[model samples]
Target: MVSEKENAHFSELEKLVESIKQRQQVVIFPPGIASFIAVNILLIASFITFFAPVMTIIGDDWEMSQKAGGQFLVILLAVICIVPPAILITRGKKNLQRWFILLSSALAFMAALMVVVGLTMNNEAIAYQSPPLYVCIITSSLAAFLAQTSHYKTLTLFYYLLHKHE
Candidate 1:
């Protein structure tokens, strides 16, 4: 026969398990469709950025090789900030949404840094690009915020689902 204290402990444990099971059923906000679209846009932008340099090189414009090389490096940085999140989302790994947020944040930071650098250098070409860069920064920041919020909600649900009493 179970002792009184043992029975009480078992009861408490049962309640805890039940609570976790209930939490496991909690509704999570699915990843925002808008954020997914924004990620795609970022990916596309990175691709465009990447190809811009290649196109210049192919144009037999040797004079702009230095500029093209710099653009290529920037494009590579953008790819670093974009591709992983796209892959994670495409694979339906909601648990990794935080990576989306981090990548988006990095993109936004890079855009802002580009703006600052352009202003500091007073380069007309860079200044001309600032408006588009600003737009990108805004969208990327929005995507990051959405991804972070969704990730937390999903994380809670994921935790409970994994820990639910079987």
Candidate 2:
């Protein structure tokens, strides 16, 4: 027969496993505003990447080299914006949340840096204002915030599960 201490330990282990299973199903912002905004931003970024070449061709002002460079930049931005959310949707791995946070923070930082550079550079080509600049800043900021929250939640849950019985 199992002693009282052994039975209690087994019960605690079972509870811990159950808690982990439940937490795995708990997503931070499913079908929520944060996720909606992130998805829309990602879609917009993709659309821009897809149509940028067409826009460059239709508009004669941009030279071939500039058009190519712009297209490359758009593609890079699209990928950076896409990866985190895609991972969250596909894998939902908790340890990878730090990467999402970093990517989103980088996007937000790039947006802010663009604004600062435009304001300080005093160059007409770079100083022009666009609505998408604000959109990028806002969306990236939201994504970063959401990712951070998810990371913290995961950590808290992990720690609770590990130490609650002690």
In order of appearance, the predictions have TM-scores of 0.49, 0.51
- Show where candidate 2 strays beyond 4 Å: 1-73, 88-92, 150-166
Give per-model CA RMSD.
9.7, 9.6
* Model 1 poorest ten-residue lDDT run: 49-58
The clash tally of candidate 2 reads 0
Error of 1 at 23 (Å): 19
Return the TM-score for candidate 1, rounded to 2 decimals.
0.49
Q: Give candidate 1 regions above 4 Å deviation.
A: 1-95, 155-166
1-166: candidate 1 lDDT, tens digit per residue: 9799856755664565466556753333355445465655764563453344334434445557676676676677666666775565444455556666676677678778877877998966666667667776777776677666644444433434435443
